[model samples]
Target chain A: MNPPTPRPQPIGRLAEATGLKVPTIRYYEQIGLLPSPPRSQGNRRLYPDSAIARLRFIRHARELGFEIESIRQLLDMADHPDQSCADADSIARRHLADIQSKIARLTALGEEVSQMIAGCRQSSVRQCRVIQVLADHGQCLGEHLAGSVKINEK
Target chain B: MNPPTPRPQPIGRLAEATGLKVPTIRYYEQIGLLPSPPRSQGNRRLYPDSAIARLRFIRHARELGFEIESIRQLLDMADHPDQSCADADSIARRHLADIQSKIARLTALGEEVSQMIAGCRQSSVRQCRVIQVLADHGQCLGEHLAGSVKINEK
Candidate 1:
């Protein structure tokens, strides 16, 4: 008789293969980011190879700084194979722009920080240039924190 | 008679000058980040020029992404004018290294994201290269993750 074919993965094996901890995998399932896998006779979760792939995709997207909501949309798009990737491109472009803006803001902030530290000059609190510059709002040449303003509006 | 000198700031004006809301300014005073200013006849808080300068210094340090604790240290150092600036320099260098490391990590992540997006050819889910790449953990070459490892020892 032919040898019996190997069975598919159990939950623990799948977690090990995917480098995801067991609890995190369960959390993903609980959050609906992952589907509930079938159960074996012992009531243990049994995951197919497909589940491993999906988990990998989620992990990669998260690394790219895609928010959970954005990842959800990407996954939904992936479910429909024949769809165009215009949405994906747009999302990626937007994320890139966001990153660029953040870099710009941080760069400007670095300059201001450097100046403040320079102003300290080991002076007494009464004569500290750092304190003087901060008190004068006009000394701040960068943007007036428009992003925080929007958050406050909410 | 000599002309009347300008009066020192009241709490409300100090808050406006420092870009801190009134409640936050009061909270700082409560927490000792700011000193309790003298009170007016109606019991309103009154601040002198030194107090205003301190508020400005705190605000600027915050903008530089210095933690409240670090700012407290810097302020303490500033209180003693005659000390060496070595402590201040060390703090700034540490903060600079942190920023540089974050930028490096983000840049690496951005490259990975660009690759993932580039791999998408708008094909059906069954034929989606992006999905294929995401689903397999062994295929990932980047070390991207949502959470950081804490190095606290028991």
Candidate 2:
């Protein structure tokens, strides 16, 4: 005979098992990344073993910096095990390229800021290189930060 | 006698001069980065010459990735030119460190993704290295992206 079905888990238990916050799991469901699970008589969500695997896949993908949409595509491919893995490979490659470009931009920005600080005389604000360069963009070494580079917030 | 007062310009002119969108200019005003300008008889916002300089300062600081609050502090320091520029130096130093850290994190993440893609045999989804590593975190090279890394959205 076939093995007995594994008991379904409540949302809390599923969250604990998946190492995802409850809100994040809910958000995934809201965003349609996670399928809506069957609910119990008391209206609590009940997840089966497959749900556990799916959530783990999402969490690990997120941890790896996969965007939500990419995670959705990956999930779709995972569900259809017979399909070719070309899309998955392409997505990973694209992500790697994106990360590399960001690294380049940040490196340039870091150098500019570093140089600005290095040139600071630490005298009055009027003579401060940091303030002077910021006040007059013409003083910048280059237009390295001309676009929407994600400079860190204080 | 002092030079003739520079004629006041409207919001649109200010936007054109600063290369900032109208909504962005309004947002800066709302956030108190740009002080509210007096309105004309028709209720059009009229900005003085001093406003142009202040808006440019805000725009440059934002392009360099300074947070709004930090810009406010910088503006205060700029207004008081006699004060020591130690705060500006410190802020630039901190931002430089932040960018450096992000570069390191992104570099690690890129390597992991690169390795994952490299190892992929381009076979069926069932055996795909990209999918496999995402499904199981244990397969990752390291915990480089375990936290809130800003992976790009598709």
lDDT of 2 by residue, A4-51 (tens): 989999888988898787887898899999999999999999888998
Count of backbone collisions in candidate 1 = 7
- List ranges where model 1 is wrong by over 4 Å: A1-15, A37-49, A111-154, B1-14, B22-32, B35-51, B118-133, B136-154
Worst lDDT 10-window in candidate 1 chain A:
A145-154
TM-score of chain A of each: 0.77, 0.88
lDDT, each prediction: 0.67, 0.84
Candidate 2 structure quality by residue, lDDT tens digits, B28-75: 889888889999999989999998888888877877767788889989
Best by lDDT: 2
